[model samples]
Target chain A: MIEKKYEFSGVLRFNHWVRVFTMLVLVITGFYIADPFIIPFYSSEPVDFMNALWRSWHVIFGFVFVASAIFKLYLFIFDRESENERISFFDFIKPRIWVQQIKYYMLIGKHPHSKGIYNPLQFVIYTIIFITFIFMSLTGLILYMHLYHEGLGGLLFDILRPMEVFFGGLASVRAIHHATMWIFLMFIPIHIYLAIFNSIYGKHGTMDSIFSGYSWHQKYFKRRKNKK
Target chain B: MQNRGLEEKLSKRLEELSKQQGIDSTKSIQSILDAKGFSRREFMAWAGAMTAMLMLPASFTPLVARAAELSDRLPIIWLHMAECTGCSESLLRTDAPTVDSLIFDYISLEYHETLMAAAGWQAEENLENAIEKYKGRYILMVEGAIPSGEESMYLTIGAHGTSGEVSAKKASENAAAIFAIGTCSSFGGVQAAYPNPTNAHPLSDVTNKVVINVPGCPPSEKNIVGTLLHFILYGTLPALDAYNRPKWAYGQRIHDMCERRGHFDAGEFVENFGDDGAKKGYCLYKMGCKGPYTFNNCSKNKFNQHTSWPIQSGHGCLGCSEPNFWDTMGPFEEPVADKIYNTVFGGVGADATADKVGIGILTATALGIAAHAVLSKIKNPQEGEE
Candidate 1:
């Protein structure tokens, strides 16, 4: 009983690359955006010259980000579910299996006991992160529009006034924007590490799958290669 | 050996210096020779510069040509009280003046404990002598606060009876004007934090004399030096704030001038450390940053030779300039604004910005999540039934 393998489509490749490219630029420019040191990195330019650039690009790329997310949603909604069913409800709740999968990656335990294109836990964690990002992206937009444009932003500012205290002050709000950068930073190494691991060990052609749209699967259905 | 030309003027002056010898001239001349000091040719050139320093209007630098003659620097008496020597370090760190230059030349330092080698009773006596010789003519610089209440036992000075500040009190009494340097001396910095054991207060608290408080954890050197220059020229104080600090240095708040202010007005925030928002360099008011209430010229004056202030360094302004800043400005908790509490504790601020942003984000995220959940549920209805 061989499990069928499905591949990522061209649209999926587009979404993945756009998300990666935009986020990388966002993170680097974002660092300078946090603080504006006047001292020049070299002789005369000052360290924070890039901070100005960060603000403009952040605003511009944010639109691209939103569009990309929307395209992802369209695909998720319209496309058929992968024959492998990598994402599932059981993956959301099974912490034990999640931990076990994580342990397998570290080589501290035997291979994971679960089977699927993605373990249940991977779907669960990604779902949480994805949802949070959507909310953050929306809030970020409202905040931007409220500032550069007029009319509706005032109403938004009025509503946000109470929570303004949550930021402590403008300086702290700047800090929040600064620290959120690390979350995306954390996700990057993890995402890359997993993709590489699948390529080398699982022999799934995971890296190319993102581009070529076809994944290698076992010839036998519903059974491990070694098992009878 | 005497000539009337500039060269003659120089040689004749040297002859007069050797012939009219005295203890003061002899000792200084000997010290200079021992140090392999400047040649006579170099000395005259430098003498021209020193003369300008003395005669140039203290408030104004004049043109480049006129500032060349030697001028007498105003006499300054630096008095230390209960302090950690940080203010001295701050003042002396000026690369422009260079600590060596300040100690050796620039201002006429009649007496300074940290910099001067003179010590014990001689040091104490020198302070008294300078005050007595130049009373109402020299600047009285006080570092650290003078604790008024109790025995003042927290700080001890040379041979003071009950109060630890016997020397400070005496030195302060005889000087022309006083500068309370550092937050401790100006506004009782950290020592005056809550429940001050010594019952510490700035120099202004103890005396009726005009005291200009330069408030900062360590006051900026330019503010300290520039204020002195202003005073020397004007023959009066720089305009004082309600707290008696120079208005030129304390007129603006850090909030009013911050570069990140746009993001704040726009309502962008970093929700947590190292999150996307943080990386994006949004605002930090939520993370307990204090920039609004504090008043100081740090944004403009900058630190380390106009290098960068704390906020620009990615740390919040601790409000070291304000009175009782330790108590009032500590604890980075929010005064009131955005949301995303410690832990996953969920709540939303109705701040005008947050409401609009939150409402829109909430509506969209909720709708998106709900739609995702429903569509997934409907797509696999039997899965949900399980």
Candidate 2:
């Protein structure tokens, strides 16, 4: 029998969609800032601040991205509606579960039974993505300090200057930030592909779970006579 | 030249100040030029150049000349720490002493390790006496980084073996203004790169007072002289950038001012060391020129008396003026894209760039997904087969 299960909570889906929107905006504007491909018309007066415009968009989305990540962390830790998400760490620490998951991915074993919402591999990858998010936010803030030296930027400067030095310099910080963007770009495709793979192969409605907060699962019946 | 009235007025004022200070200013600048075999015409030419360098109007030429003439009024104390004295050599080692160098010579340098003839106890005594005498009046110029914390033992100065950290702290305690004269003093230079055995730190890290960083491997003579002149002319610090470098000199990116910038805009670049494009004097961006990121006036004020700089001579900018350049802007013969840190595998993938690793993982994912799809199709021949 096929059973419908209410899996993802509304808050979790909201945070996911916010991350999606902000990541797309951040990446597009970030690449523009790095190497501005657009130019003002040659004959016209060079007055348009195209680079600055792109940079402002990038920073705005960057903050939104960070806020969404923080919200997700809060959900992972304290959200009563998603308390089971924290139990993924137990699966992450189990060597047998990791081995079974790897074997299943290698096509040598049946799909491993996961104790929580995510498998061990998914849990680990998500953890790394979170770390990358933190790094991106920090380097962005450091770079921002140079552009705006008053108010928020000035305050960040005093706090983040030592961190900049620890990272070797502003240049290294920039390199790291640009590099971390690529991580998200790489993750997005695999994440979608895996979701599709699971949805089709597992017959679990995994992809629809993110959007509709419900998924279908196989139900097992005990060896007993029906009441009817 | 055209501003003769301003020139006369400044000269008269300088004379009165000279009388008040009991120092002869009438021929002090002229005498230094004469001793160095430099003519009054050459000095005037230099003054004109300085006026232009300082971004002043033509009328300010006389003001610049008078500033150089009155350079003696500014008492300076230069300290040498964990450095090679390259900054001092760059300023003072011209085959023929330019008027700029003479102006530096004309300054009332109360104490300088490289220029002074005194040594050992006598040199120590001179430093002590100068610090005591000038008190809070002299400009303190430091040439190198100071070892921090317990690593202060790495660099000890004077006959009594006083640590660099201690010396810098003491010298800067009573300074009117402080200038970190090179990359070493500005951002700890190479000594603080990577492993940083000495635990070296920039001059600003050790002192509470604001330090105007004049950072370069060896900063241009014009930059050094221009900063000093600006201080003398205004009697207050010039505007500073985020790095505490004088905005007048470090405001614009080297890429914007570079002569090869046209080539960069046109998308013509030098791909290799001796390629046709390189021979054609194309942009060095492909060869890891850090000009786009580096903020300095190397292109505007070329080194060795406005002759040529690194980019002009077919070499990429080392980005030496920037902080921690040795660690951040290295593999200087290639573009920055190739040096992006491999964040995935950490040190194991140190040589691999983010692009390479990212593309590698992406390609693998695509292939794996394709392979997995094929395997799943073969394993499950019909619906609900499992």
Candidate 3:
């Protein structure tokens, strides 16, 4: 019952890193398009197209983000590897896990008895983050139509027009999209810190497991000590 | 400043053109154009300009001109509420001053406080007569925000006991269609900005009618004329966007049609006023230009007869044509901040604050974890391998 158990599958790890890379591209390019901080040249001819270039990158990556999100959603639902992740939703809402997680994060309690790969808080937070990613993708495309007049961007106009109105015009849509970016910005540091914290504190090689697809189960340490 | 000289120059040209066409201000459009002196080709050229401003095809020029000539004169009831009269002034400053002024002759202007010769009770009587005579037939044009608080005492017309809302409601009661002219009337312009003390409301919000918003600080002369002509010719309202603005006028962002858009796309920006970039006509995106988000044809349909626009004059857009622009599109020279977080954190500014605080928290977290690791290592030397 205690061994190096496979936690993240190759596909899940691929999706996770792809999301990270696309998000990085999106945030940098999006911010530049929102307000270009660097003035490469103040008096360049109109043909420079720097902002347009950033926008193109932003939009191109935007689709990649969308595709990755959709693929992640597909994997979440249909892939057997994600069955535990799906069931973690129930554990995430459990009152006992809530209390245990709070105590653990506060450093007052040991890791609670858990049946899922992700702890309750991680489950909850990741779920919310993914939901936000979906929203950001939709709103981002809605705002993108402002610049694009033909091709795939133009085709999406029929759909985004009504959403733009429902969201209270372009300004509000842009504001919401802008504000959500800060969420990801804040999430990255906390996410990295927690990953490293768990890896080092539990001696579980959790960080390496993302790439290696196997983690030394914490219970394996207890079983090995008993055998010794 | 320079606008004065531009206006004088524009008026002089209009005068000279009218002389060449033998147009008399006293005569109607039909009379002047039909007169032996005025050619059909000249009229067609003017029609073409209006068509282009309306975003209509070249083929629509003859159709628009024919409509202008054959359409029945619309009866208009112009009402002033909580406004600065800027919309009216814009109309007066039209490049083709003679023809733009002739828009009055084409419409039976039942009541106009600024331009009507009638004064005092005579004006009141004129309004009443127009309403009674053209009930359900005239175009009711409301030119400012309608104050709704404290019995609407914030704005009143003449010496009567009538508030703006009251008068607007009565006038629009039986009108065929209502036109909310100017940002104030259409979207509560400046009066409806934050801390709107007067409780100003746009015409659509105050009334249950199908209101058409010709929103601008003051819309261009062509838009005003185009909207009126569309109504006159088609006997129905032009297509409207979600904001109730005519789609042709407010369909696209100013950034799309801007002359300086090349600079914007090229990432060349004017960082400050009178800077070399600004002097050299660089994009004003960095200087808080709201053109990218603002949906108006100001670039193409330049104010004062295509003379200039805000961006052309080397200033960022105020986003005047947009709804709640005063409240939403501010700091005028800086991008809008995330109000919730900025205000919550005592307005230290955006992006930078988030970045600093984010980095600060992460650094503290790292140090705390490091210290904890060291303490644990001292107690249990094998903690890393545990």
Candidate 4:
């Protein structure tokens, strides 16, 4: 028999989607700021501030993304409902689980059993994505220091100046910031495809679980047995 | 004319001061105001402006003036390599102290290839004499990149066919301080750009000394003068950034002080040259301005006697002062490419490299996902009974 059980809380779902939304906004605005693909024309009154407008939005959402990430980190550590997700770290470290996960993706083996919210691969990939997010934030702030005479941007100068030098120069820092955006772009499609793949092929209602915080699985699944 | 009158008096005063401690360079410097039509007030005003340009506090103006007038006229040897002599021209063409002040009363410029009337064996003798007399005391100011790839045949100076690199190294070995006077000397300007056949290198690269880089396409006259004055006053090189450029002048990006920055913040940009927005003094960032990334005091300092800078003239900054700018900040108008590993996939343009990699991975991902889904369906035809 199939049984339904809660898998995610409302907070986790909200934060997950917030991350997706912000990443999209950040990428779109970032690309426009980098290239300004818009052909400019002579405007009599000169009201168009497209690059400035996009950059403002990018910074605003960047703060939101940072806050959301912090909140998610807190939840990952202390929230009871997130214990399953935290357990994924253990599976991620196990060599056998990685072999099984790779084999499963290669279509040569069945899915590896785990007592966690995410598979080993998802855990490893998500960890790297979060680390990249932190790196991007630091580099982005360093670039932002170019615009201000004082205040937060100015205050950041002491710390960021040496970092700029360490990275070779401001130009190199900017290059790294731009390159990391592509990493996010590449991760998104594959992340979506896998999420959908599991929902259909695994037959566990994984897609609906993200929205409703519940999923149907075999009553005798090992995870359920362990929970009892 | 008036400056020439001052020079004569200064030389006479130098003869008097020379008897005491060989410090004849100072007495005449203090008497510069008494020489002709110029006033002490005019000297002070020039000194104040120079101090301000050096990013020094207002209180330092008097100190700067005193240092300028009373300090020993240190010997300076100006060497030209693969350069156009534009840096020398910029100094000579300015109107403040004018070229007369730089040559006559300024540091005793003993050997300058461009300015010295001597040539052939006579000029070579002057350089040798100055180096011997002031060895380990004279300042060595290099104005161009040194081509070391050949026997330095690309640019040879002196009668002995001595390569530029060899000559520079020899001069720097005994110099009190070394000043790299232009982008070519400081950062290997145009000659070091991509496909650098001559294998040129900046003064710092060719020499072991800590080079004080006054970098610009041709650095502003004041920057060159200010650097020399700072050395004379402090008896040490000015504070420098990571690129060895003076922190006072290159500490801030041009974008910070740009007048059109309001347009940038407001998002108004000139789409093209001679457009209405261009006429209205909009930001030139859209037209490939590198001001946002370039660090220099150009906006505040200006060029040609504070008349205007590139942005004021309705063009974007070429980021000429930064290191390896030719290869790194290219296609001039577009933002620099975001590559951590520059020169990794050699010969590919920055954006092209990113584009090829991004598109390649995205395409492979899409195709792999599609094939995997199709294969899964074929393998599980009878298993779907939901």
Candidate 5:
């Protein structure tokens, strides 16, 4: 059995819990806002209460997204990275390695080909989601700008015209937003399922590692040298 | 001058040659001239101006020089049934140089219930006599839908015109070509909405005749003017849609042309009667405005002397121009479900707007982070080591 150790720090713990908190805010409120059928509350005004609040929350979380992205990017480019814990562009396409990472946990394979901070699959998905969130942020800003200044909105509209028309104009843009919620929703089950599975199979109790800023391996272990 | 020798002599001959449309055999043109109601010179001058008026942009001022031409004025019959006289009022309100009354000039206005001063038996006689004398020659103008529930007594044309103006059905059948004015006459209007008590139907539905429907609660006067002139000069139906109404007038939805459609796409909405949004003149659709579905020129042409319309009046359009609009369309409230889900109608309803997009982005990002946290915990035991 491989030895486990606690290596996470306090900053990583704060980052993890806050990230979870913000993500929950984004998902529940986001879905409620997209369809508005989520919760029913009587409103004295013609519009509902949660509806009015969604705007403030959305802007607030927009900054959350912006901060997380900047912080994560900073960590990727400049943080101390050991040879066994590094990310590379080739991780985007290595399907066999991803499946091997999965199979090792499924008990379908013997020794796991383990040597990195992020599993290749995890690295690829994160990279994609990071870029996609940037895209969402851009489009969201363009749409928000529409409310205040139409000239700026029009310029953004010109850039998004293909997306706008392809999605069938303004209506399609809305649907794209609404439909994207499902993407997050689908991610939840797979995310939780794998978190539980890897913790059990690896005997690492990995769930609170983000909150506590540490993960458990098998008590004590010999560290390897750099790959490059 | 030698003018009298040839030109002057020929002028007299040309004047004699023009007896025109109304010189009945009972009254010789020369004999009436001698009796002196309107002198031949004055009568010819009036006729000359009327002839010139046809090619004129659209005005009552007679422009023709004394050519002693002929009577191009077609015979027209205005028929009213199952209607408030609003369409007639719109016609009368038509811009000066009065296009509606000019329609009177193009066609001999032998009988009209609203315009003609003649009424009762006298008016009834005119309708009968005109329809008789100009059977296949005159055009019949119908305003308002024809109610089919019970007896023709549901509407009475009063005894005007020559034929005693029977039920709207009989009158519609006897006409040369029918011109159905107003949304009511063209598409049964609000009276024809679901659970229609009157069972009102457009003129086109009542008879097989290709009725030219000019649909709008009160269609724009310019549309009326244009259709009438086009018919007079060419004697053919203007381009028509499936409804048989002239397509030139009714081919577009109000949203396609509205000034505030920009606000609609951006998800801006007027949520109440006097909110800041309403004052801003944003889309009334959230208020159940039907501008999106209603097809008419009300927004473009405007109403009440071209000043403002429903959306401009701070209310959403009720889509009065569309068939059964009162039933199918809610006054400009939230867009229909399809608009919310499948369209750029922008972020669901007007109230939801930017928030929907914001929520969507936030969820995706959060889930990405969750997904990564879980995956990271799995890889950490060995992957973090070097």
Candidate 6:
């Protein structure tokens, strides 16, 4: 028999959807700012400012994406609502769990019991994604600092000048920013596929847990009942 | 005492050289200024301006004037390799010829292929003699990229057909300082862009010495002369940025110093050429202006004797001052992100942009995921068995 259990809290689900919305907006507007496919009417006055409009949206969502990512990171480290997420580090460190997870993915072994919400593979992938987010944010700020040289941009220029030099220059920083956006594009499809695969094969409410805060559990309860 | 001894030696040598050439060396700079109708007060104002441009104290105006007068004492050997003579032409072709350009003209340029009267065997002999005579005291200024490696044959100098690489290496060997005068000499300019048929490299790559890069398609006269004056006055290299470009001239982006910067912040831009915004001097950010990426004093020190620069003429900055700009800052009328990595994976055809590559990989990933899902469904006959 399947038992419904609370897996993600309200905060986790909120952060997840915020990241999803922000990423979508950021990508679309970022692409537009990069290429600006929309051209204004030739006879019309040059007051459209289509590029600037798209760029403003892009900058707004870029900040949102960074803020959401930071909140998620904070939750990962110190969220009292879900202490098990922090325990995911244990799964990442265990070689036996890694082998088992690989075997499960290859359809040669049963899914390894994870002490935390994520398996070893999931933990590692999430860690890398978070790091890429940080890199993307830094390169984004470096590019932004050039456009507006006053207020926050001025402060960022002073702080991030060394980082810009380290990456070679503004051109390299731009190239890196464009390249890292592809990382997100690559991750999204695979992430969705894996979530769907787990929900279908594992007979658990894995995909539903992202929308609702609960997932279905069975074996753990059976083992606990038998022990009682 | 040592400094005075060197000054005395320099003056005596100048007098003897003037006597040999039948020219008055004592009043060369002053006489030239006077002939050009530049008063002493006007010259002092120019000196003060130069001092400010060099980021020196206001008190150093007289020092700068003195340095300009003594500039002829310093020997400079300018070499041209694998480039258009645009940088030289820009310095030489001013309407009235500013004090800086005049100083450049007055300097003891021992052997310049463009400026020197000697040619062929005689020019080669002059270069050899200059290198021998000046030894470690003369400044070596390279005007273009050096074709290096196996493609060294692409740029051969003199009747002897010596490679530019060998010539630059030899000339810079005993030089007190080296100056890469243009983007070509600093970062291998246009010839080094994409495919790079001649395999050109910046002067710094060919020589073992530190080269001060004055990188532009043709850097402004002020920047060129200001760098020279800095070296002359301080007897040392000026502070350089990460790219070895003198920081005083290339310290800020063109976007920051642009007159239309207010429009940029106000969300006003020239959507097209000859538009109302363009006529009104709107920011050229949408017109693929590389001003944001380019670090140069073109806005502050306008080209053509401070008359107008690229932006002032309603054209966007091409980012000519940057390294590898021909490759990095292209589709010059579009944003940098529009076309990047022009020669990816060793020439995958020029049209292959970063976006195309990205979209291609993302499509393949989606296809792979679909195939994997189908295979998983087919292989797992006992559904929900776990």
Tens digit of per-residue lDDT, candidate 6, span B13-112: 4444333331225547888898878899988999999989987667667777877777766678899999999999889998887787777766557778
Task: Kindly give the stretch of ten consecutive residues in candidate 1 chain B with the minimal lDDT sum.
Answer: B63-72
Tens digits of per-residue lDDT for model 1 on B54-80?
333222232211211111234678877
| Candidate number with greatest lDDT | 6
Report DockQ per prediction, comma-separated.
Answer: 0.02, 0.20, 0.46, 0.44, 0.03, 0.33
Better candidate number, 4 or 5, judged by DockQ: 4
- Candidate order (lDDT): 6, 2, 4, 3, 1, 5
Instruction: Return the DockQ of model 3.
Output: 0.46
Name model 5 segments beyond 4 Å from true.
A1-228, B1-72, B94-108, B149-151, B156-166, B331-386
Best by DockQ: 3
Judged by DockQ cut-offs, the docking class of candidate 3 is: acceptable
Candidate 3 per-residue lDDT over residues B1-386, each given as its tens digit? 65456335434533442333211235456675565345777778878887676666676676567556532345678899999888878777554544555555443455688988988888888889888977777788889998995848878777586888888999989998899999999988999887898999999988898999999887887777788777754566888877888888888899899999888878888878998888889888778788877888888878776778899999999788888888667668876432223333454534343344555666776687677666544543254344
After superposing candidate 3 on the true structure, give the runs of residues whose Cα lies further than 4 Å from its correct spot: A41-47, A218-228, B1-27, B32-41, B57-59, B70-72, B94-96, B149-151, B336-386
Residue B187, candidate 1: C-alpha displacement in angstroms: 1.4
Chain B TM-score, candidate 2?
Answer: 0.90
Q: Is the docking of candidate 2 incorrect, acceptable, medium or high quality?
A: incorrect
Q: List the residue pairs that clash in candidate 4.
A: A49-B267, B288-B333
Which one wins by DockQ: 3 or 4? 3
Which segments of model 4 are wrong by more than 4 Å? A4-12, A37-51, A70-96, A115-117, A221-228, B1-42, B57-60, B70-72, B94-107, B148-156, B337-364, B384-386
Off by over 4 Å in 1: A1-228, B1-60, B63-73, B94-106, B159-164, B273-281, B333-386
> What RMSD does each model have against the real structure?
19.3, 7.2, 7.7, 6.1, 15.1, 5.7
| Model 4 docking grade | acceptable
- Please give the distance, in angstroms, between residue B314's alpha carbon in candidate 5 and its true position after superposition: 2.2
lDDT (Cα, tens digit) per residue for candidate 5, span B1-386:
55335345444533543443542334433343445444556654544433333333223222122221221234567777777878777767644433233334333455678778886888777777887777676667788777764633455446432221244556666676678888888878776766677677777777777888877777766566546554643446767754566666665567778888766644566767899878888667657666644557777778755667878888877676666555445323654322322225454435343345445656666676566666655655555432
Error of 4 at B62 (Å): 3.8
Q: Please list the C-alpha lDDT of all candidates, in the order they appear.
A: 0.59, 0.81, 0.76, 0.78, 0.58, 0.82
